[model samples]
Structure formats: C-alpha cells, structure tokens
Target: MKSGVTNLFVTVIGLAAALVPVNSFAALGDLYEADFFSHTIFKFTPAGTKSTFASGQSLSEDLAFDRFGNLFEADGGSGTIFKFTPAGTKTTFASGLSGPFGLAFDAAGNLFVADASSGTIFKFTPAGSKSTFASGLSIPNGLAFDRSGNLFEADDQSGTIFKFTPTGSKSTFASGLSFPVGLAFDGAGNLFATDQSGTIFKFTPAGIKSTFASGLSSPDGLAFDSAGNLFEADFSSGTIFKFTPAGSKSTFASGVGNPVGLAFEPATGIVADISTRASVQTGNQVLIAGFILTGTDPKQVIVRALGPTLTSFGVANALQNPVLELHNSTSVIATNDDWQSAANANQIPTSPVDYRPPDSRESAILITLQPGAYTAIMSGKNSTTGNALVEVYDLATSTFSQLTNVSTRGFVGPG
Candidate 1:
C-alpha cells in the first residue's frame, strides 16, 4: 500500500462519426452545403463557422467529394456540373446536362449524374467526356455507387430505386419509396436514402429495405462520416439531421434556406487513444495520461476512475477505492473521490452518460475544456492499492443522443 507501484487498464464506449451540433463545442467535420434556391454553396467548419465555399452557380442541387479532395456540384438550372478545388477555384467539369440532381464518383474516378429533366443517368469521364449511362427512367434524381461499382438512382417520380451494374444494365432495387431524392452508402455496403415524405430508409446489400428514421422536414441528401453517423439535409426546414448507425436522430445544423446537398469532408478530426493498467496504488505513483484537443472552443469531456468492480472481470485485488483528477499541465482543474458525489451528480446523469461503474467507491468528473493538452490521473485512496480503470470521453459529439460508455482496454507498466 505504499505510494509508487501499480498497473492499469480501461475500455471506452462513445459517439461515432457525424456532424456534431455546434453547441457541443466539437467540430463535427468540414461540411459543404448547397442552397438550391440561392444557387450558392457554403462551407461549414467544425468550429461552427459558415462561409461561402463557392457561388455564382445556377441551382446547385447536389454535392460530391472525389478521392483527390475536389468538390463537385450539379447545376440543375444551367445544365452543367462545376468542380472546385480546395482553394475555392471553380471550373465546369461537364455540360449539356438536363437538370442534374444527384452526383457521385466511382472508385475508378468516373462521375455519374442523375438527370431529372431528361429521366436519364449520365456518366462523365475524368477528362469530361459525357455519355448516357442509362436512359428511359421516370425522373432519376439521387444517385449513389456501391463498393462493387453498382450505380443506384432514386427515381423520385416512380417511387422506385433502380440499381445498375458497371456495364449499364439496370434493375429495380426497391419500391414503395415516397419521392426518394438522395442516396448514400455506409462502409458496410448498406444504402441509405431520404425523400420528400421526411423519411430516411436503409437497405441491405441483399436489397432488403427498412425505415431507418421518419418525421423529417423533407430530407433531400444523405452522407455518412467515418464512424458511420448518417447526415441528411432537409430542404423544407433548412436544417441538417444526424442519425447514428442504430437509427437515433439529432439536429446537427440549422437555419439555411433550401438546403439541397450535404457532404462531409473526407477527413477526420478527433482521434482518441486510451491507456490502461491492471492495478494502481499510491506506491505505484499516480497514473497520468495526456491528450491534445484542437480548435478554439472548449471540449466537454467526462473523466472517470474505476476500482472494486474489476473483481467482476476476474481482476484480482481490485483497488478498494480509486480517485481521479483532471489537470491542465500541473494545475488541477477537477478531482473526484467518489462518482456520485453531489458536486458532479448533476452532470453525470442519463443515457449518453450510461455505464457508470457500479461500485459506489469509483470516481468521475465532467469538464468543458479549451483547446490544449491535458492530463488525467488515477490513484488509490489513502495509498491503498489494487486493479483500477481510468478513462476520458469526448462529450461534445454525444451530447444529444446515445453516447455509450467511454472506456479503453490496455495494460501498462513502467520500464
């Protein structure tokens, strides 16, 4: 029970990739939105700043990002597609389109556009050569390409989704959709769609369809983030909604007029790492782990320390009592002796904060922090020693919905 010998380990459960709400203080991602009525495209940063990404267009209906970081927008009114570089440089990539609505890129760099006015699907080469990939559709509006190079078009007028092979042969994929207008695919090869009826639908690789979510205000576009969070643009409400892989929904951004396109930057911001040990005591010294949070806003995080409960996991000699402290450099910001202490009880309630250690002797704290490096320390109370757990969870993204436990599993010992 001396003050310097120990071991530790932890497991974290938390939020996935999606557009985070601005107030949560975490940058969801770099997002580009198209205003169909204004004929403008706007860029939103994770820091909650909105600015013009590109403008001077005619009815920018949909957006897509290629592997090289170029942004593409389909101009329905001008019957053209415009491409933009990261520095906001714009150029016409394709023309002679007939009210292009949805835009997508295949793995080989070919572009596919859904022509609403002509009821045809057009394919564009990297060099701008255009050809009719599929014709005779009843208003193909939203387009998506699966991993296998299968092209999908949402025929809004016929309420049928059509799937096409890379060779251009087409077949009906699903029916009964209400004016389906946008389509996206997740990493697992599943398809998601939104429609004028304010519903979002999910489809399995085998063509099984199910309602992923309902009751939106005319959702028009669908896109997913690295962690499987689905984002949808609502044309009527001028808002964007985020849905978890499990179908939980939350408002991501709001107050834009006639939003038609929503695309996440093909990049990630918050990468988390956790360190663990089997046991820690005062003799083992305080277990300290550090992390850096980028951006200007304060990041809301939950920090916790666990003991006693490890016995359930077959951990022998679980720390009888573990204490936790959060620090900026060497300055202590918060500390906890027990998780349910009145000081932090108000902040640690509800589902996103679920999976609290069952042992009353555990410790936890919730903090909103500015951009910088910080450290979390876990130690046994009164120099008592045993197995324990320490974890830091980012709360900015999970503030609205089902944010599970933030834990990490690892083993640690001094050299």
Candidate 2:
C-alpha cells in the first residue's frame, strides 16, 4: 500500500508540467532582526509576531544551557560567565578569568571554560571549585566533549585544536586552522569547529582535520539543530549559517548585529549572540547565494519560496507535477522534488508540462526574471543513498546569475 501511494505521488509529479499555472502564488508573513551590540535576542514566529528573550549583556560571545533551564552567557568583555535563570534572574556564575569565550558542560555537570587571555582551559565543578585542567595553550576559545569524556579545545591564536584526556594529558588533535573558535561534536564522535575566517573544519577523533565548509565571513560559534545540521554565527556579517555534515552551508538568519555565538534549544529553535552592531531593519533581501555537498553520498534537494509575497511563485519539477502552496513566513513554501535529477545536463522547462536538466558542472539553478526581494529555501539528500547538493540563486539584471559548487549534505533556507 505504501509503495502504491509513493508511485501515485510520483505519477502526479511526472504530470506536473500540464499543471504549471496552478502553482505560483504566495502570502507575506512576519520578519524579525537582531542587534548584536544592543545585546538583544528577538524571536519571530510563524504568525509574524516578534518577541524579545533577553538584552543588555557586554560582549557576550557564547551561550550554554544548564540542566535547570538557565542560560549561561560567556561575557568576553567582562571575562565572566553570566547565568540567567528561567525566571530572568541574572548572576555571575564565574568571574575574574582572562577572556572567557566559550563554555561547555560534561555529563558529570562540570563546566569547562576556554580562557583566551591566559591561553588555558579551566574546569569548574558543580560545587564551584575552580581548577586548571590544562594550561600553556594559545588563545583557547571553544570547548566540547566526546563520548569518552575527552575535552576538545580550539586555540584561535595558533589555529590548532587540542584534546585533553581525563587524566589532564593534552595532545595536538589537529593543527593549521584559520583562527578556530567554536567547537561541537556529532553523535559519531567527530569534532566540528569554526574559524574566525568564515570556514568550518571537521576532525576525526584521532586528529585528522579536513575542511568542511567555507565562503563565510568570520564564522564564529557553532551549534547543531535537531536534524544534525550545523549552525554558524558570522561575526563580521551579522548572520547565522546552517550547514550539513557533508560541508554545505546556508544562511539561517541574517541582519543580526555581528553574531558571535550560536546555541540550539529544542524548545526555542536556535539562539544567537550578537556581539557588535545595533539591531535595525535594513530592508535587505535575505538571498541564498549557493551551496556545496562534499561528502561521499549523493543527496536530494527540495526548493521552496518564502515571505509575504511567496505565493507569487511555484515549483515545476522536470519529472513531477507542479505544486502550489501558500507562503508562510516560517513555513517552507516549495515542493519536495528530486533536485539532483532536475539538475541533469541541457535540461529546460517547457511550460508546466516539460522540463530539462542542466549539465553536471552547473552548480546553480538559473531563474531569469524581474527583480524584487525574495528568499529561496532548499533541502538536499544523497542521490546514491547518502546526501545531495542543491544551490539556489537570487538573480538580478536578468543576466546576473548565482552559483554554488560545494558538495556537502544539508539544507539552505532564508533566515
């Protein structure tokens, strides 16, 4: 029965070209922006409503959540960690450190701090005892833990990462990073870190490092969403990027004021810490430039239109039926089609009934039309049982085209 349903769905999609005109309208929705310098965090819901969670912290660079639902903020300016309870009571959990930038908690509830000033890592037990876990580092800024309780630190000054055993012994896990800062771990024990130069690195537990993603402007803090997508906070551009383990990165949020930190709360989606600039609505369109998928698997991709005027667009897949849906500010507004299949060479769209694929070397989907503010959302999966690469472009001048060549696993959407 399931197979029959699937086949019917495929057949409907295969006949989509004849139904093209039925899929091109949209509705507008709410939008929100964050001011990093203002120390404010704004939330935008599906209904277009906006809310403020917190504000007024001095140069907050990283954030972590405790078991009690409290938000711990690393105030790099004050060299302290500020704890904000669920009730909004703020207090300094630890202070008097040299540029405390990143914080992490182990399974035993011990808090680890990356001190950039002293080039060391400090461990604070739940009872508040401060002890040096490792010292003589080179500007350690981000910290994470593996399944074996091993600690990983990203040294920004040396562009190296160190792994500390449970016995306080440290070894070089990876080196030659471009000012690596933020660190996170996938369930498989692989370490992911971001550099201040707008790149992401993946390292094996034994110390081999590889470039995971690039083309960012000062990618700082890193987080992972529920779907295993990595999120990055771009300090220079005031934006957030959502990347896949395969190496594809896309803008998750924009117009943020120098976003320096990122955290994912299952209950709140993604939280970012803006360290510089003021929050303002710049009226700039959140454009999806392109994407890359570099892993060993083939991936799938789906594209959607978003925003108040999203209903004005529809997706016509070469092998599927045209799907028309209303655009929600928070909802993905595109059809679920095999983007990899649509990317074949010399492919073209013949009304709502015919379509053609471009060459394999072509990295982007070219759409020539009038200019206006728009957002393009894409999801990718492996074509050969692994992952996919789908890149979208915001074209202007009718001849200006967007391009993406990254071959990593992940989705790209408007932030």
Candidate 3:
C-alpha cells in the first residue's frame, strides 16, 4: 500500500542479515542497543537476530560510532565513557566526567560527549585525552553533528537545542522544547529532537520547527540506520522503534528493560532520488519522473501510477483513471493504463520483488533498463483529473539510476 508499506524493513531476516559488500571493507554490520535498567547491551542484525554485544555497565545512556567501526558508550552513573572494539574489548575512552549522556564523533576522528550533570560538553582526541569543548549549559543530554561539522546539544533542563561552532561558540538554535532529550539529523540536514512530552520535532537548518512525529513515550535516544530509518529508544515502553523519513514507526526491538540508546553500523550513503516533487494536477497532466542509469548490467524497478487506490487513503478528487508512459528521454518505451492488463502482469512469483497490483485499474510497469536517462509520465485517462500518486521502486538497490526529478512542464488543459 502506498499509504506506507514501501520502506525496507530490515529485521534480522534474510537479505537484511545478508552481508552488504561496501566496496573493500568487510564490515560487521550490527544494530547496538543499550539497556539501562538491566545494565547490559544487546546487538541485533538487520533482520532481528539478537545477541549480547557488550554488558556489565552502569546506567549507560547512549552510544556512538567512530569511522573505524569501534563503539563508544556514555555511562551516566559511572561518570565515564567507554570505547569498545569490534572484538568486544572495552577501554576507558575518557574518565572523570559528570554523567556523560550523549556521544558523537567529529569528522576529524575526535569524540564529543554531553556532560549532563556539569552542563558542559567535552571533546577527546583519538588517544583518549579529554578537554572542555563548550560549557554553561543546562543538562545537555543529546549530541549530534550536522553535515557542516557544527555540533548541537539538546538540553533536558532548559528544553532548548544549542548549536556549537567547530571552535565551540554556543548559540540557542531552538528554544521552548518540552524536555528535549535526544537529537538526530536526517540526510537532508533537517534535525529531529525527541522530548519527554511524547512528540518528536523536526527543524530545518534555519531552525523552523514542526512536528515530525508524536505518540512516542519517553524517547531518550535517537540513531539513524544505514537506510536512513530513525530508531528511537523508548524508556517508558521498554522498546526500540524505527521510523521512516516520513515518520511512520514500527517496533524494531522490545522486551529489554528501559532501552536507552542505539547505534547503526556505519556505511557510506548513496542518495536515492535527488529531487522529488509531488502534487495534484488537473486534466490529463503528464508528470515526468526522470532518472539516468549507470553501469553495464540491466536494472529493475517497479513503476506505477496510483489514482483510484488513493480514495482508500482519504485523497480527494483523485484522478479516476490514470495512465503511465515511460520514455527514454523523448521516445516512449512503455505505456500502461491498467497494471493487470500487461502481458507479464502478476508474473512476479515471489517477493521483496513483488510487482502485483491488487487493483485492476492501477497502472504499473516492471522494467529492466540499461545505462541512460529515462522518464515516467503520469497522466489522466481521457480528460480525467484531480490527484494521484506516481511511484518507482528499486528492486535491486543502486543497480538502477537514482530518480533525478519528478515534475511536469506540459500542463494539461481542458480537453
């Protein structure tokens, strides 16, 4: 259903657990979760296989990762932060801190932590020597860095988000939060903060805030997985929840007492869809979505235009009948009106690659393409109009080109 079910849910099953070859690095990809009350840590594979990553901790509140794949945890009760290697060996990364709650690593390999009790932020070298980075905060709990290397802190006491320059100059980025406790950033530079009041706020780089999500119960830590899904540690529910960039959430892990923090395995991200513009148009409007495939092998994707199905989702005046025309730039390569009418329609026998359209009226195309720029145009059938959804799903990761833009230049006039 276009309502939500299109995202990649990586439980510890099948392809999610299978190794992703990231160029030359043999990465041991695992999801690390910290249990504060039980004083232990658990690791889950992408498909949900659970195991102990580390244990024997004292109120560990958060976790971070370095470029080398090592993990660091902030022990609020012990007042020290510990670093753990891939081999599960722990070393005192920095000591004599005041309830270190949040941890982050800068681009230069230096580690930073929010000293919650002292209302200060600390920086440490790769060798573990510590120094004060910024001071005079009110219970700074959550720490994160933007793409520009600027650091941000979520203050639980003052309920504000503070921005710090690379040289440690501090400014109030956002204020008037309801006990802001966890901070995270999406790939688009939008910042997300979780509050004790059960809402997650999203802020642009310009600091304009909006509600990204709500109904969370005491979410205390935030971490984004390799696929860009945000995972939150819910202290009250004792569960870990995963949210898509659009803010639809599902349970990822549960039953551990007071889960406080999580970390995803590190990988370089290749962006999917450089630009996307979605809207409702009138008449027989042709919405063009273009992408340029690279590499030599053929790529597969599920291309579809949704209209009648949108009414089930509360969409008003949705295009009663929609048509899809795929182009290799200027020439039409494929056209479809009803998905079930295609010769190979419903031919996909299994899934993670399923292309079956349940509604006979929906238009879909399962295409195998080569290295070139192509476009998909969504239009109404015979002057029909209003609104609809045009979507493309990659069946084989980045094997296909990323969608460049979804837009329309030729407006449909009254027929």
Candidate 4:
C-alpha cells in the first residue's frame, strides 16, 4: 500500500553554547579583521555589520582562531602574541619575538608564528613551549597550513612563497611576486596569496600559478570562508574585498583602518544533533536524513531512532518498534533495531552528552566516520506506520572536523 507523511520537520542543533563564550557574540561565518592602525580587532558579519571583537593591541598584524574559537593576535609593534577568549579577555600567549607578523594553527593545536625581523618561523606547543621551526628566510610575513600538514610561508623581501614539510624541509612553491604578504588555502587545496603590489595570485596544488585578482591597494592578508569565498584585506584603501569561487569580486566591508589580517569563524558550529520528526513507514516511504562531515579529521557520532519515546513528547501515534539504517554513498554501513542490544551499547552512554534512547525498542548506532557524506534512514518494523524521531549526535567536538549541510526527505502527508 502506498503511504505518505506530512509535517516532516528537521532541526540541526549546533553545540555552540559549549564552545562560545557568554559575552562573545560572533556567529559562525562571520569575518574578523585585525585593524592595525586602530589597535583593535573588528568583527564583520556576513551582511557587513561591524563590531569590535577585541581592542588595545599595539599593532594588530594577523589573526588566527584555535579549535575552541579563541582568537590569537600577532602584535608586531610590541613583539608579542596576544590570545583573546571569545568574550574579549586578553592574555599574552607569547612574547619576545622579533616582529611577529603572521599566525596559524595546525591540526595538533600547535601555534605557528612568522617573525619577520628575525626571518624565522616559530612553533609553540599548547602548553606555551616554544621552538624554532624554520629560519634564515628573507622576511617571513604570512603562514598557512595545508590539509597534509605542510606549512607555507610568504617571504616579503624575496618575492617567493616557500613550502615546508612537517619536519621543516623547505622548497619554493612560487616565485617572482612583488611583496607577497598573506597566504591562505581553499577547501579544494588551491593556495591564494595577496601581493602588496596590488594583486592576488592563485596556485594549484602542483605549483601552477596564475593571477586571481589585480589592481588592489596593497592587499595584505587573505582568508577563505567555508563557502570557498576569498576575503582580502586591502591595506592601503581600508576596504575588505570578497571574491567568489568563480573569481567574481565584491566589497565585504569598508572604512577599516589598515586591516591586516582576515579570518572567518568556522561556519559549522560544533554539532550537537540533527533531529527529524516524521511519519515512519516502509519501503520508499521511510524518513531519510543526510549530512556531511568536513575538515581533515575523523568524527565520532551517534545515530538514533526514537519511536515510543515520541509519545511523551505529544506524539500519540508513535511507532512501537522502529528500525534505523546508516549508509555511506548507497551502501548500508550499519543498522540497529534496539538501542540496548547494539554491540556498542556500552559506549553510547559515554558520548560527550547523555544521548541514550528512552525505550528499549528504540534504535541507535554509535560510529566514527571520516570526512565524507552519509545518510541515516528510519522506518517502522513490520511495515507499520507511525511518528518517529531520528537523530544524529556529534560526540567528538574537539577534533578539527564538523557536521554540516543537514537535509531530510520523506513522503508527504500522514501514512
């Protein structure tokens, strides 16, 4: 018999409350700028609303965000690196550097700084232990990391962009530039550099270089948002320009005082869960929810289907027994019929948050997934039809990965 479901609603809950500070107010996808002349860090929303994120730096040169959303600033004028909580409390992360110019964070939570005056790159452990990572360059101005953990640096005086292996083996990635000051990498592995000569350049993973944009006013720092849009700090013109993936340009913000560093807060907040409440049925009428895991690290998540528990939440026609199936690109990866009987039932309760199903007949699957797309489908056992709630919960939020682009599909109208 053909059946349908109506009012199928889906909600993606981001665990931002745990990562964002009480006083800090920047949403994900917002752009942050280090205003050098203003001695302030400015926050610009995606719609161009401006606010002061942090203030009182001697000379804010570059900005980077740790996994926890804390902002790190390079103050070249004071030769110090300042760390600011999301709420704006500031502390010195490192000091005594010779003209700190750039900041970046690797997957391991280590911080890298470019010391322009000393022509060196320094690495700092999470515990504040410092060590020389690379040296003897000609004015290292900007630092960035590729997915493979290789470090890229722009040498302002040498007109070259150098790539360094994890062990500091250096090789020139591109050359013949005019004062390249800022470096960034897009999701597709392409490198972008801002040349103070009023131009921006793009380099493929194989080192093929081409001009991305030209006729800028001393473009200094560049960064990419999750959507692959490039934001450039036009140092001399006091404007921020955004370029789309296809090279279309537009103004993102203006009237900033010598913006030097630009960074976009991660678009996907730590995902708490994505829940879909729909009428569960059999065959092609079942509820299916899809999501993508992005970034370079693996993420642990719990998928569950709640049927009887929905009765307590005003769902009267709840399915007594629900079934859940997880898929990776059309192949069934896992399935569960009862939450308590799953092989990893013991580990389900230990998730970062308590996410145990209330009824023994409910279904749950706890698994760790690599960066990819996945789907979870929920249905009623024995071809029965009723209301059911399917959910996916992220358990490992500290990793450099996130769950995003959640969607759902099901038949329309009640089954």
Candidate 5:
C-alpha cells in the first residue's frame, strides 16, 4: 500500500517477501493444485516457483484452506480428508467416507465435504465433530460458499448445481449441465462451474446461466484469486488455465499431470500485517487505511501512525508529529495522537515483540473490532504536513477470524 499520484496497490505481508508494487501477476500468494492421477499436490508461488506441498496420497481430489491457515485435502481413493499445517505436516482430519470429492469451509470454520460415491454432504465442526448436512445427490463433485453463507454443490452425475442454506435446506441452483465437476464463487455473487465437456459456466445469484468460457479439456477444479482471475484445473490436458474477469484465457502452469483441484492460499486470506507509506496532508489528503474483518469472532489489532521515527530509516521530510484515528462506518471509534498518552499505553509496547513505536510522539491504537468495515486515518497534527506511514497489525493470527481486504489511500507530493 502507498500513495503516489492516485496509484493503488495491495500487499499481503507476513509469510512472503517485503512490500513491492506489481501491476500484473499470476497469483497474490500461493496456489495449490492437486493431481488426481499422480496422487500429489503441488504449490506454486506468484512468480511460478513450484514445489510439492504434499504427496503420496490416495487420489487427492480437492484442496481448501481454513481461516487459521491450515490446508485441507479431500482424498477420494482413501475415503478420508487430510489437514496440513502451514509447514506441510499432515494429519487425518476425518475418515470413513465413501469418496470425499470436494472440500469447503464456511465462515464459522466448519468443513463441508462432498461424498461423491455416497451422494451425501457432511459438515464438520472446528473440533472435528461431524454431521450429515445433505444427502441423496447423484455425485456431488465440487463445493463452494457465497458471501451470504449459502453452500453451492456441483452434482456431476445429475447435471445439477444445488444450493444449501446454513441449516441443511437444499434447492436446485442450476440444471442441465454437462457433468459439472468444479464450483467456485468470485468476490461478487456470481458462481463459476467447470464442466466435463470442456466448458465453464457462469451463473448469477438468480440462477441465470451463461457460458463463461468454452474449448477446455475436461476442466475439473475452479479457484479465484483476489484479483478476480479464475484458475481452472484442466484434468486431461495436464495444465491449468487462468482466465481474466472478461474470460480471456492463458496457461498458468503446464506439465501438471491430471490436475483435479485448485486453490489459492489467499494472500488476503489471513493477513498478519499491512502498512502503507505516503505523504500526509490535511482533510481528504490524509493517509486513510481501510480494512474488513471476516468471520464471526472479534479481532484485536494495533494501528499505528509513524512520522518522526521514519527519519531514522532515511526518510526525509518526515512529519514532526502524527495523529491517528480509527473509525467504523459511521463514527470515530478510537483516536490517538501520542502512543504514551493512550489508555493502553503500557500494553502497546508489549502487544508483540519487535512492533513498538520508537518515538513517543507517534500515534498508536489497540482495538478489538467485530466483523465489519473499518478505517484508520493518519495525519500530521496542527495542520502540519510531511511523509508518514500507517500500519495495522493483527494480534490474534491463530484464531478462526482474520483481517482481510486491507487497502490505503493518500497523497504524494514531490520530493
């Protein structure tokens, strides 16, 4: 994040390289693709660097991630779902299923598994408690959830897509497809499904259908990056195709043998830190940072406004003093002109190691916010102006809830 002549960019820190602005890229974070025939899952970085995330599975069918950064895989041949930590340690999360094909996670951290052979949908709590969510389908191959919490299923055999409410109510979302094998939803409410007959279908929230793309080779799994680009795992072609929002396609990766499922690690998925640097000014030109917290639980974050301290790092024209304010939709929730004077001054220095503002005049705020939109503004006090930095750090990174969709806007004066 930065401010430079109306330029806008997003960066997800904490588990990747430092802040660098890029115009076009393959993915925001990491992308995981499962090869059904090889029984292996491979991970790729934004620059196309590849490595085996996990291997030696009994037919890896699908890949998904929980809010806590754990990766889940559906093992179709073994009838089990495996959970992998951030470091790739594997453990059997569930077992005794009749072919787990598609895996999805709801906002409440519940894992939904589509049993293709049994025609059943199973739900598992965060603690691994399982219950039957839905049943009597003709082979559900893919699963996804919309922002409204409605679960969508791709029934490959029946040629139908089904929508299920949070409480197990089911309805037909779309029908008459040519073996829909993969399902995904973009940031918008629109749904994308990959069909076995070399075509991708797009469905509106009202169930209206249209062909998003055609001439594929047995496309199986669908995933979308933060930039709204769709990645399709073309099963028979041994390749993955990336599609822009308008449906233009390009080869993202090749030589992938029988890729079945695709999932991006979600750069914006579980952000640990976000910061932006820009020239500060008054009124609308003040550095304003925006973020949205998803999931059910509240999140504790430390918001900071840096100015004088930046000069120690070779930043010139630093603001003499900075003031910071945190706001919800309607009103200001918290404000801090100086960190030492804040109500939680003692706790601010120790919230986390290596994150204390060196200058006492810098502004900081420690807030516990519920799931919603928020704004953090940084400006110089007394109508002063100079370069400054604004930052928000998530404190509870291991919790089920996370900070996401973070952005910033400000002015950029000449050096």
Candidate 6:
C-alpha cells in the first residue's frame, strides 16, 4: 500500500510539473556611453545601475567589440582607435587617421574603420597594422559586412551605399539617401541604414533601395534585434526608435541626450547601445515579446487568464487578434494597461493562419507577456470547420512552440 501511494504521488508531481509555465530567459546588459566631451565610457545595467568602463579619452564616436570581447572605440576627434578590455584597461590600438567614425569586424576578425573625413575605409589586423582597404570618394561613416564577406559603407556626404569587394573593387550599391550614417544587415541579407535627415533605408542584395522608415529628427545609428526589427538612434531628439520590417516606427526609448552610436549586444539581447555626447549615465533595457495565432475561425477565439500576480492585460493585432497580459511581478511596474485592452479586443480566426499570406494563408498575433509563470487559456469555436489552433512564442529565445492544433480544444498552459 505504501509503494502504491508513492507511485501515485510521483505521477501527480510529474503532472504538476508539466502544467507549470516555462519562461524564456534573457539577460540584458546595460548600455554604455563614451561621451565625446567628457572622454569617459559609462556602463549602465538593465536595473539602471551605472559603472565606469573607461575614462580620459577624446571624442569617442563609435564602439565595436572584438571576438575576444574587447571594446574598440573610434575617437574621431583624435583620429584614433581606442581598445579597452572588459575590465577597463585602455590602450591605443591604432592612431593618426583622419576622422574614423564607425568600426566593424569582418569574418576573419579584421577591424574595418570608416574614415569619414578622408572618405576611406581602413582595415587593421588585431596586431595593430593598418592599411587602406578602400579610399577616395565621399564621407564614409558606417561600415557593415554581409554573410559573404562583402563590405558595405554608408556615405554621409553622398547619401549612398558603397559595396567593397575583397579585392578592393568598389561600386555604388544604392544612391539617393539623405546623409546616411549607420549601416546594418539583417538575417535575410537586406541592408538597413539610417540617415542624418531622419530616414531609414533598406537595400536588397540585388541593389534595390527602398525607404524602410521616415519622419525622425536625425537617425544616426542603426541596429537589428533577433526578431528582425530595425532600431534607429535619433541624434537630434536623443531618442531611439524601433521599426518593423514593414516600415512601421515606434519609440523604443527617449530622453536620451544627443544619442549617436547604436549597437546591439547579442549576448544581452537588448536593442539600444545608448552612448551620449556627455557624461551623465542614463540607460535601461526594454523587453519585447511576440505571439502568433492561427485557425479557421480565429475571430471567435479569446485569451483569458488570472495571473499569479494579476496586474493588467492588453493585446495587439499584427495580423489578427494579439492579446497581451501584464502582471505585477514586484511592488509596481510600468503602465501596461493598454496591452491588456489590446488583448481583450483582439480575436483569432478559425482557419489556418499563414505568416506569409496567399498560398499559406496564416494569421499572426503579437502581444507582450510580463515576467512570471501563469496559466493562459485560449478558447474558440468554429461553426463551419470546427478546427482551431493556437501557438505561443517565447520572444527571448526566438523559438516557437505550438500549443494547440486542429484536434485540440484549448491550451491550459505551455507545453
């Protein structure tokens, strides 16, 4: 009888563990800023904590991390490249250039520096030997590399993108940009860049240029998240804007002071790098969550939940009904009431939803889920087909696990 009780207890514990929700873990590193005037590099953690990385430099414009995790800063005013270890040991890696603005690393771990004043792109080895990779033309400010090792540089003076081959041959990939400064490439090989005139542009590998986003004060630096969303640093307004691949723009962070350089730390998974022109440290980490739902009668679907903490809820419809829930994990959190309303108003369809429509015909829903483990219930009835499906996304991992399908009635929690 005791052995039988032990078996039943084990089974119940296993079932309870299966019902518990699993959260995707994300560690957001703080944003560090190297003030040009103060000549200091300040590091900010996600919890609004601050530390000094390095100090006593001259006009640091851009920063890049090496394979060994050492930070490299472009001191445009001094025409030098400052290299610092993670613990803040600073040294001059290279010097005596003519206004190096942006820096990037190639696949082979070579450093490419963009000299804006000389319109030149210089390549430097880890040993500090510098050579002119490409020269002559307009103000080259930002540098990026594609998967195939081709280099793309953004010219602020010409508002054009120059493609440099490994053999040093250069060609204009796209033209008619507005003082483009920062350049970045997405997973699809599409190039995204920001201009001083407050516009973002996207270029295909085939040389097709299109305006991806616009109407900013002065977009200086550009970066991408794991979800393919584009982020732009606005120098004029000291704000950071997040843009969807479809050209939709939203304010990611604001109240920055002369924000210029932007880089995403993939290890931390945050969007903004947030370096200002001055010395006061101010930065924060913004968490983003995404959800996708599909079914034949999604319009009849709804998500209901009583959180473990139960703060608020909302939703959005990137394609169909996208619901968001917010809970008070601590004493108080940011206002997430709008997200809850958005969730309640959004509804899913009853048919299969395709992310890429037409042949597949799937619908997608996006919502922000606050931190905590809670029970989420999705329910809908399709009168015509009697088929419904739901999917949950853990945005931090960039992984998608299907929760329910045609034969499933509803999802109690996570799988």
The candidate scoring highest on TM-score is 4
lDDT string for model 6 (1-415, tens) is 3322111112222232354334232344345554445566656554435556777767767877664457789988899998877677888899888988888886445789999888788999756778989888688898887756688888878878889887788888988877888888876778888876667777787878777777788777776654566767677776667777777778776655555665544334322111111011112111112222211111112222212111112221111221223222233222222222333223222222311112112223333333232222221112111112233422222111112211111212211
Give candidate 1's error at residue 213 in angstroms. 1.1
Q: Rate the local accuracy (lDDT) of all candidates.
A: 0.73, 0.53, 0.72, 0.82, 0.82, 0.54
- Per-candidate alpha-carbon RMSD to the true structure: 16.4, 20.1, 18.6, 8.9, 9.9, 19.4
Tens digit per residue, CA lDDT, model 1, 1-415: 3455344543111111122231222234587899989889988775547888887889889998764468899999999889987788899888887898989876545689988888888888766778889988988888887756788999999999999998988889999878999998876678898877878888899989888888888889887764578888889989877788888888777887888988876554343324455546464355655555543223456777888888888877788898887877558989889888847565453542363668889988776666555667788878877678776666543111122222322335443
Give the winner by TM-score: 4 or 5: 4
TM-score of each model, in listed order:
0.58, 0.54, 0.59, 0.66, 0.65, 0.56
lDDT of 4 by residue, 27-59 (tens): 347789999999999998889999988888888
Worst 10 residues of 5 by lDDT: 14-23
Candidate 2, position 183, lDDT: 94
Most lDDT-accurate candidate: 4
lDDT head-to-head 2 vs 5, winner: 5
Report the lDDT tens digits of candidate 3 across residue range 111-186.
Answer: 8999988988888876676788988889988898876678999988898999989888889999998899889887
lDDT digits (tens) for residues 127-224 of candidate 5: 78899999999998899987667899999898999999878899988989989999988756789999887999999888888999999999899988
Return the clash pairs for model 4, or none. 4-413, 5-413, 6-413
lDDT of model 4 at position 324: 91
Ranking by TM-score: 4, 5, 3, 1, 6, 2
Candidate 2: segments with Cα more than 4 A from true spot? 1-36, 41-50, 266-415
